[model samples]
Target: MEKGIESIFKPYLEPKEVYKGGKNIPASTKKIYKLSSNENPLGQSPKATEALIKAAQNIALYPDQTDIRLREALVLDFDHKLAADQFITGNSGSEIIDMILRAFINEGDEVIFSNPCFLPYSVFSRWYGAKQIDVRLKDFDYSLDVEGILNAITERTKIIFLTGPNNPTGTYIPKAVLEDFLARIPKNILVVYDEVYRQFADAEDYVTALPYVMQGYNIVGLNSFSKTYGLAGQRIGYCYTTAKIANYIRQIHKPFLLPITSIEAAIGALNDKEFIANTVKTVQDGKIFLADAFASLGIKYWPTQANFFIIDPPLPEMEFTDFLMAQGVMVRPVSQFGAPGKVRISIGDQEANEALVQALVKIKTR
Candidate 1:
């Protein structure tokens, strides 16, 4: 018999724990508040819902392989004077990250990113046989040490992943710091900026890297319809870079990129500016409410620019998570992100937020 498989696939033989959404509570539970995933509590846009319903009739037809309409809509949405050729659509933002890795990384190359930014950056880098250089966050505030990142870079560094309003910690990169880092890095290295949570960020200093791409810098900005548009189930994501890099990703892109329904939904979502504004407002309000609640309970939380925040819970993270789960409230334990004592909570609607606070209070008292 032949050997089982290539040695490169050995690390993946054991499945890793992936990101998960909130779970359905047991039947005996009276009420369930799903605050695990950082999803729009108000749900998907009404316009997108209507579009999806209408597009359902044409399910048998193949989607636009080139994603022309979707790309055009995105161009208009960004208002960045971008050509449609500068974009590449994917099933999700996660897939776009994968595409970027596959397009640039070779065995023995190095991928550098913060220690706890996004899990996929590390996972995908290892899968591609690239060495992962993880720079630890400065202090416990989850601030990115740009100097540390610059120091970690070497000739073998092919890519660096930066996530704004980074996952779990909700920290962000200021525009000035980003520009300084870019200026120091070699042009041969490509920087992937994951801005999936950009819409939720209210920070004045946070800016998209599209300008860098337009300036012919080696940077790609990855975005998604999942968060602000509440189209997570639709699985639509896109990236913008220089025409050369965009064409490279497209070459690796399989034909029939996204489902027809997803295309229609993204278009509808893009057209509904009022809906997107309302979603942002809702998240902003929820974040304030949660912050106040956490403070009342004497909990320490990292200041957040994104829709979620990490709290140093009174109990162990898993224990706290279990306590909340038993009360029909689900939140994420940050152990997977390397912070065993902290828990990450997604900002939910009024009712869900209240339920989470009450649950925490109950746990603290008991």
Candidate 2:
């Protein structure tokens, strides 16, 4: 007798909440300010637009299988610190994460991350039958509990995920603290750092994990052109790791995985330093503006090094999000992100920022 499909999947099945993005406006609504997704408020880069257009002219040709040009561009952009072979470009940082899991995770292996870290870590881990370990962050500032994570490690632990300027909470690991944690971790376990929002971080102590990768630790630093380069739609990202690990990850990744246009857009976006500079400045300025408004309104919010911040809403998380939607504004209700009763709001353009502030004022009075 053949096994049923349900029976085949029963052992791996578990209740999981899919990643939820911000809500879209009703079709009938005349206007809406979308501050839900942490998208580039400045819009796509002009240079990227030009490059993608040029690359599209040759749509019949397949993209470079080796991604040599894109890797060369990355080397130049990083001031030649890392070789081309050390970087592995992929469709997106999320895809690279999946590749890492596929390359390393065996059945029943353990993967550890903070409770509210990136959603996909656990999502992919489950697909591979890896045991998921959630380490609760420190309560006061929502920072990663280094001690807790260290204690959670066991003989079965295969990988540990860390996010600088972590999502939903906007907290970051300081350089000194991270170094201390890294020093003590067993050399066998891989440490993957998701630094997708690194460019927006201005905290004096915050640092990227690339140095550790160069230092030959089993570290992988993942970056995406989606956020800082304004190429989310393009879906281009890369990871920097040791050559041996890069080769292993490449073995798992399919060739010609990215579109020609995405590769070109990322290359072009690198040339547009002005656009990246402007984006960082805009988010920084908007962060200050929004934080000030929150303080004046007596609304509680946490400090963030990323483009988005979390707030303790006046009402229940879902209720507050619904109210904002009714007011023609969209924000992310982050209950599923382990941030129950809070909402994460992304920094938007000036007009949208003003609209969100106005909406908050209404929430206060209502």
Candidate 3:
């Protein structure tokens, strides 16, 4: 123990034995299609790979600190008020989140968010000595309860994080409802709109957090190249905030955190409009396939606008997930997402989805 470091360390979340599903599957079960995390099953963008290889040629040099190309690419594609001054790149969406909580929250300040969201929001909040406030979703649809969230705020509230086409449940908040909530909330509080899965949305009512940025709600919109562009391995994600705040964050950001190759590849992925359009189509088809299978199995599922949906398990989720692993399929058990009886399954490719459905049926019949 370092002297001053020991007193500053605050722990609120215990590290669970995270099931990085099926790391040790038997050889017979080795053919398993991992649909555990909401990853792009179709794999990385072809263009991203090409760019990455070209970038690998420059490995001898230190990565560029500014990461110019990707920042300009993001600027041209998005219509928000953000300039290059307003963006701060990180290794991933989680890294941007960790930066925000540490930079903005002081000890004892309250952080509010919907329950069962990405676990890191609460975990990171507590790590900063801030209070964690969870407002329960109304039902399995995982629709946000605006009144519930608004009531949770007080003078102590420092941040409110809301995910659109949210994780685990694949549900979204409607524009009118979101507008109403945003309008009513106290102006001082910062609302972080995490839009990692926004690209997978099939609904006509979907709202990107960009407009909120334009309106200057003291909001920060977190976007990722991970899901749609299949740049997960490159770990590129960032936030759009007011220019002043972004400059403030840069003071604490690790120098050269964004690798030059990731910037080039991410830039390349953005211009691969055809590949992105195709990825969206594939993900939509997958959502339909999973929905149909759930209906046929007599299992209930939330109506999803994202490429995944949450299912109410007939058996306990952890046990059911273990059973699926034995049959050479993998899924996320939502026990860790604070819904012990339900599990989330990412919509994979056609053959993989079919295999999952078959394995699920066999498990139920037994």
**What TM-score fits each model?**
0.95, 0.97, 0.92
Candidate 1, 1-366: lDDT as tens digits: 666666446664357656544455457637877788788888999999999999999998877777888989888987957899999899999899999999888888999988676788888777777888998788657888988989899999999988887887899999998999899999899999988999998888898878899899999999988889999888889999999989987889898878999999999999988899998998899999999988888999988988888888898878888999888888888777766678889888889989998898998788
User: Model 3 clash pairs?
Assistant: none
Candidate scoring better on TM-score of 1 and 2: 2
Each candidate: how many clashes? 0, 0, 0
The numbered model that scores best in TM-score is 2
- Stretches off by above 4 angstroms in model 3 are 1-29, 79-82
lDDT of 2 by residue, 198-292 (tens): 99999999999888988999999999998888898887899999998998888777788889999889999999999999999999999999999
Better of 1 and 3 by lDDT: 1
User: On residues 1-366, what C-alpha lDDT tens digit does candidate 3 reach at each position?
Assistant: 558855645555346333232233346726888777777868888888899999999988888877555667778777534587778788989889999998889989999988677788887787777888999777746789899988889999989999888877788888888888889989888888988888888678789777877777778888888888898778889888877667887788886778878888888888888888888888899888888889988999989877788888777887888888888888877766767688888788888898899998997788
Model 3 C-alpha lDDT versus the unseen true structure: 0.81
RMSD of 1: 2.0
Candidate 3 lDDT trough over 10 residues, lowest sum: 16-25
| lDDT of model 2 at position 74 | 93
Ranking by TM-score: 2, 1, 3
What TM-score does structure 2 among the candidates reach? 0.97
Candidate 2 global CA lDDT score: 0.89
